[model samples]
Target: MPPVKIVTDSTADLPEELYQRFGISRVPLKVLIESQIYRDGIDITPDEFYTQLRQGKLASTSQPAPGEFASMFEELTKDGSSALCLTLSSQFSGTCQSARLAANMIKEKARVDVIDTRSATWGVGLMAIAACRALSQGKNHDEVKELVDSLILKMRISFLVDSLDYLERGGRIGKAQAFLGSLLSVKPLLSVKDGIVCPTQKVRGKNKGLERLVEIVEQEVGEAPIICAILAGADPEARDILHQKAKERLNCQEIWLGDVGPVIGSHVGPGACGIIYYSL
Candidate 1:
């Protein structure tokens, strides 16, 4: 049997180089800005998307259609290689549903297994990377799928957004909705819990928020070796600082830096940074 091919949505927010390195395929989500539609990470870049947001332009996003996923899967599996598709949290978007529909469409012609990772951004990206690593170890398609499913349960994702306005506008505020309209200076620390964004803490300033993020991770994982991914939304300084702090404090076995793409950035806004990891 051919090796399993790894696939994910653009919301995974993995760096381009990693995709090329792992031979992973990604389906693009739609981003609407200033009356024009762009594919996240394909038609528009994170830098360009944030530039428009800073200019006071509103943005919205949509999940790719089932046909998009079907076309990609059929092409990848033409040679009889089974495909494993990892998607963003079902609670956050309908991307997972779309992938599932496509999997059914091609069930007879090819083997496609779609998994709702119950995570987003680098959270999904980390799971995809783990799948690739398992495949490299000569694990079969079913074995790799089981491994990713376990990682989904162990995944811990938390982020600090500069403001809750964007999330509120996008209707993804979740339990963090309470943080809205409080104080302009308050930064909300949120986490992806059970496939949805949930409030964790509210800090008065960005500096304290960053510190609190590290504290939360340390409290959860301690010195256990972990695989981590640091995410930034047009804020490299914050990303670098968080990366340094994580390296200094945690027993990280593997770590990578990724950017928040247009789709996720539309909701999180700029100056957002976070960490996603699972202990090995």
Candidate 2:
């Protein structure tokens, strides 16, 4: 059989270097801004997406077409190798379900297993990195699947959004809608629980919200050695603080810092940053 292939959606938020270095194939999700369509990370970037959003444009996102994933699996598995499709939380998007349907459409020919990461943004990115690390070290699909499953249990993700308008527009407000009554000033802290977005805390100021985010990290991760990813939505100050504090406080084995692309940004809006760490 050919070497096992790793696959994930662009919502993972991993940098291009890692994708190239690890042989990971990423399928782009569709992003719509002002009725113009762009591939999540391809035609549009986080900077451009946010810039457009701030300019009074309405933004929305769509799941990848089933062909978007099936064609890639067909290409990657033509040599008889299997693939594992890791996706963002199903609650966040239909991408995971789309991937599963894609797998079904190709099952008579190639082996492709679709898994919901039950997380998003840096959380999904961290999972992809761990899978890449395993695959690079000669792990087979089954072996890496076990590794990823274990990593998921240890995964912890949380973030602070600058405002709730994006979430509201995206119809993912959940319990975060309670914060909107704060007159658009409450900085909301959110996390994935049971694979759905839920409000965690609401702070009155940006700095205070970020501090609470880091504190929540410290409490959850506590002294374990972890591989961490810092997610930013075009916010340098928040990213720098989260990165520095993660390094300072956590026993870190590896750290990844990148902007949360359109998938997450379309919901969180700009000026947001947070952490995703899996204890090794």
lDDT of 1 by residue, 75-117 (tens): 9999889999999999989999999999999999999999999
State every prediction's TM-score relative to the real structure. 0.98, 0.96
C-alpha root-mean-square deviation, each candidate: 0.8, 1.4
Off by over 4 Å in 1: none
TM accuracy, model 2 = 0.96
In candidate 2, how many Å is residue 107 off? 0.9
The lDDT of each candidate is: 0.92, 0.84
| Candidate 1 root-mean-square deviation in Å | 0.8
